[model samples]
Target: MFTIVLISCFALYFINDKEYQQTAWIVLIGTVFTWTLISYWIRLQESELYNRINLRVVNYIKIYILLIGFVIAFYTFLPFSVETKNIVAAIVLGFPILGIPVNLLVVNTIDHLRSSNSNTKYTLVAGVGDMAGTVEKHLLRHNGSHVKLKGFIKCKKEECIVGEDRVVGDLDHINDYLRNNPVDEIVIAIPVKVSKKIQSIITAADYHGVRVKYIPDYRGLFGENYKVTRYGELDAINVRQLPLDETYAFFLKNTFDKVFSAFALLALSPLIVVLAILIKLDSPGPVFYCPIRIGKGGRPFKVFKFRSMRENDASTGGTKSTQKDDPRITKLGRILRKYSLDELPQFMNVLLGDMSVVGPRPHRSFLNQKLQESVDKYMIRHYFKPGITGWAQVNGWRGPTETDEQRKQRTMHDLWYMEKWSLWLDIRIIYKTIFSRKTHKSAY
Candidate 1:
């Protein structure tokens, strides 16, 4: 609708009559206003995650109807000549006639291409019985190219029909397997009667920040809060589905991350150059420091930052946290660290898709392991990409994790942010990161 009205206004620019132009402006404003409301009500901007082609088409049709009706009715009341109205209306109404179908076709084509591409989920099955095999078959049939079933975890006394080489380990060792692997999700295919075993697996999943899903054998097995989504014809319940788990939410955040990082880097390029020169002249080391940090899915990636400390073992991967009077920090480095100017280079990490604009701050490997052992569900923070500044950082929980209290509090704040995440929450975090004194309370 906006496109139609915008094109009409542009075309009206060449017309000599001011009256026609005025009418065009009014129509554009009216169409935009109507669409703003309609889109909000229908959540037209949200990505549709329908796995079924028919369901996607049905949704597209419903949206098309609402849009077509609004365009036709909106143009009818305009004071323009009948010929003008007809031409404008035809152009507006005629668009979706071909546009919507083409859009669907293109979307499906992209999906097909993506299925064979790198966004694949590394999955693990938690049983080796009939149900487990059935679940595997369904996943293969529906998302064969997208979901890579790494292996299966066998249950005690369960008959194993799958090949012996395919079994990674048994249920008792699921935690060890998860800790050493990059698993995205664990699908429990065992019977609901094995509640204790299921709880153990769920606990391991929580500790490792891997998603847990159940192939439901009973309707009331899962709680009301658990989301029951279709896996082809089968029903699967996501035990703890965060908003970020949705396809649209992922797309929205990822898109924003890329755009925001690109813009920030471009706008701050001059400042970055100055800082780079200052760092080089201030110290005898490199301008930028790339430290190994654990990112999404527990994958290790080098986090980019201005070198805030002397080049040493600690500068890259040492477990020691910076202290207030640490001699390792240079003069200019101290000021940079105090105000977080050192973190500007991490926008490059965000641009490279290794991080987010707002998330739990990434930690060193030793710190990550220690926290996983001491803090409950600490690894849950790693479920999403790390950020340059995060909810914890903005809430005054940004410093050393020497105490159990600090570790727990930081993890809790991160989990809270994950549960309550939205584009608005991210914006608020960014605002506080820039202006709030508490955000810098722990900076040294």
Candidate 2:
């Protein structure tokens, strides 16, 4: 929808640009290449392997368009007799910059629909022990999550308990069970030595149109090297490592961080002053609170916040995250922290390149050291810049780290956010932070 609208709007703009006809250079390029680009994008969807790469190529095109927009706008102020109209026409094409991701999403949805309709449903072996447990979990976690089982071809003679259902029969009854039920997948959970005996059972299921999935005694369905793949059809999204790390994604992200942070600091200067006054009148403290925090790569930096705690005149202590009923918290501090008004000043941190508008939230040095010692994969989060707000805060993990479980989950969320970082993703997190009431929760 956005694509067609943009193309039409740009075309219309070019047709009307008689005064600045020289600016037609941009419009001419867009009009001539638009259909070609659309064709190539559709071709990418027809194949499975080229889909992701092609989508990224499309992203690069959008980035180029942004650069083109800036250049065209810059040249517009120049004394262009006819060249100005052409430039304006070219700039119009950039209006639908958001269409790139939208189009890819639509294509992915269609692909998922096709993959779901494919024959040969996955089968499972409902048995006893860790192998069985792994197989069952994978089966349940599979895209459809409704794959039919032939029966528990139990390696041991005892019946297995699974979600109030018991194994009614064994490998011997596999034939009989399929005769009476719909079973098209064979997920073998038997040990390798015992697997030889179940080979015929797997063959039987395969002969009967069932796709076989072996539950390895090792670990993970597709290995521990994570790969996050999604099929839009069944809404199945797996947390996995991507083979393609996007340089363009990084470019777009840093560009957005710098651009938006600068713009926000400038645009919100007035609001900052108003909040500064409120803080001064409502309590005794400095307008801005500078807290020591760990930034990207374990570097130390001072994070900016609207002062949300009493400036203790005689108190002496190392860094500490806020907790409920802290004596140093003023009435205004409570309000500011509750609504996250205290975080506004971090835009300066973002501008200074010490933080991102969206990423893992930075921790006080004390909390950072404590968490690093207790949590696995904790330090991995420092690979990316910290943010004013983060995934954990939005997901109800914000407050004080009172419990080990709370801190563990929060750290896990921070790692997850880093692993899944992307420009569109950052934008989504920002949207949630700005609009979601969950972010306003107050806890120690």
Candidate 3:
């Protein structure tokens, strides 16, 4: 499709006038190269691999912007007459806009047909409970054509909530049953309480070389952001994890942080210098305060902030929660804290790899320990790199934790952000931080 569009674009612009042919060819090649690079970068060529329509639309929009931006930049640099550039720009922009709908239609049709005619896999369910029943019903209702439900393996006859007719065998006979029957996949929908039975079924499936998938029962547990992995041949379940934990995601986010921080520090140099001078004149302490704060994985790092209070001997004073009108706050500190200018220095911390642009805000070591004691899952927020501004902060959960409920609510919002972390979500949080009216409402 890309090649066809490129050829069509070239043909449309190619004229019999030889004087302009060279310029036409140059523009055509440049446009095609830029379009191809952007398409590959955004994975538009692999759109068929995804099943979500909304994701496909987003990919198309990204490609559209890239194409238009490339055309604008390419034309701006080319030494061509205004008339020629305008004509070339129109041709280049039209191709991608025209191609998007066609590509969407082709991809959607192919996906529908592929799903409709896909080969059915023979699947068996192990264990019988609410989770098992829910899985069975979902398969029967939504994936009926793509999956064949063989039967269920009951761990205990009395405990089996699924109908007895669907029970083909018990856990004791699972190995023997697989030895005789041909099963493509085994779905282990068992609770953690019955670990021995689940392991037995998994081992049997492994010996038979059949794929095994476990459906965890997360009742009364921190079930969000669960991931399964192997640790030296032993299966391990991760209760709290983030997409940033993956190698690609970590690299992408870290690279963005470094590049953005460098740009911000350079761009805001004038403002930073002026602020530093003002801070020194307004207070008797250093211009910058580097306080030790807990970071990702509970590692301690010095967080950078402009001095916003008077010099004090109490080391714990900085860690102690601040109120709306704390007397310790200096006259100039009020303006800095209200607009979050005090956090500008932390961009340097982001450059140093001690923080991210968007994540759960880091807390002082003393406050972290106290929060951990009061909140059971308080440390879970440390699973990701601390950020200068976070989901909780943007949602008005910043500042002093005056009550147990306030601490829990803040932690809950932070955990939700971790579980739902995405590049888009990060962008949204940053946008809200800058534009939202209530952004500075909770700040002291």
Candidate 4:
């Protein structure tokens, strides 16, 4: 999306002038083709052998439509003359006309290579019925050829339809069978009503650390709004999908973080340099301080900050919070903390994808564990990236989780932000972070 938008803007100027029309077209086409190839080069980042080609095509089409829509919406915010509209339309539409075919061809070729026998996953079906046969047939299909069926397992509830020679063992010995076999995944094709048997099979699969997939037979158990989704080619159901789980939301937030962080770092280089030098003069310690903090998915990562304290035990791995007029704070450090200049280096963290511009603030590892024990659903805040500034911070829940009420309120506010996140809300938080007195009230 960034590649398309950036090229469009660059081409806009030259395309408008009749003298540079050919040059503009060449630049636009060449840049886009280069990016397309780059995207293809790293396309196997997920390392999946077989891809759902239809799904890939659908995703590309959705992205293309989204790009066109974004362009139109963006143009609406600008004052465009009739000639500008024609130039913009041609630039946007013409690129996709040439790009889509090339994209599809590459996708098909890659899909073919990926679906080869070289990376086939040996799978075991934990039943021998119509559902089991259906799964076998599906695996043999063109798209699912990457999953090679090892054999079927006999079940008391279902009559064997597959050949006797294909039966690895009965469901009761599934644990033993998996322990001695090299199965990549096990598909449970039995009825959902057989709860006890299914539980036993799941336990066996879990013990053996084998991936488990189920044939969907629980349509009556869930609401219409709860739809089936895919994990690779295997169908599964989700009760509620978060906003960030959507592709466009993830792409938009990720793009905004990278672009905003890069721009902020470049623009703030002078101030950053001056501050680094002052930190060295003010205190005899490192210019940057990195302390481990709990991040997304409860993972621990070192958070970057300009050092604002005299080197001490607390400055390293200690979970202690700074207090009012703390003795450890240096003269320049106090000023930096007052206006949050100390946190300016965290833009590098944002650029590194360890943080976001706005979300729940990351807590120290010990504090995170303590909150998990004291507060309900506290860990849900870790579902997304921690931020330099957050809704809780903007709403005056920024500092010192000393009491239960403070901890609870901060977590509740963070959860609320996750549920109600939008670009506009992020903008509001940023505005308040700069201007709101409440945001700085608890800053030590």
**lDDT ranking, high to low:** 1, 3, 4, 2
Native-to-model Cα distance after best TM-score fit, residue 152 in candidate 2, in Å: 21
lDDT per residue (tens digit) for residues 343-367 in model 1: 9999989888899999999998888
The estimated TM-scores of all candidates read 0.55, 0.50, 0.61, 0.50
Give me the displacement of residue 210 in model 2, in angstroms: 29
Per-candidate clashes, comma-separated? 0, 19, 0, 0
Highest TM-score against the true fold, candidate: 3
Q: Rate the local accuracy (lDDT) of all candidates.
A: 0.81, 0.67, 0.80, 0.78
For every candidate structure, what is the RMSD over all alpha carbons to the true structure, in angstroms? 17.6, 13.1, 8.8, 15.7
**In terms of lDDT, which candidate is strongest?**
1
lDDT of 4 by residue, 213-306 (tens): 9885554355333556887989778754567777898899889888988998999999999999999998898999898899999999999999
Colliding pairs, model 1: none
For residues 1-444, write the lDDT of model 3, one tens digit per residue. 464456555665756777566666666666667767887887776654465567667876786777677667767786778766865677656755566577668766665664563555789999777778989987765443557788998876337778889999988899888999878899988766675677778789999999998876764254556677888999877765678778998888888888878998999999999999998899788898777889999999988998898853265566566777888899999999988999999999998889999988998878898999999788988987999888888888887788987899899999888878887888888889888867788888
Off by over 4 Å in 2: 1-245, 312-314
Which residue pairs clash in candidate 3? none
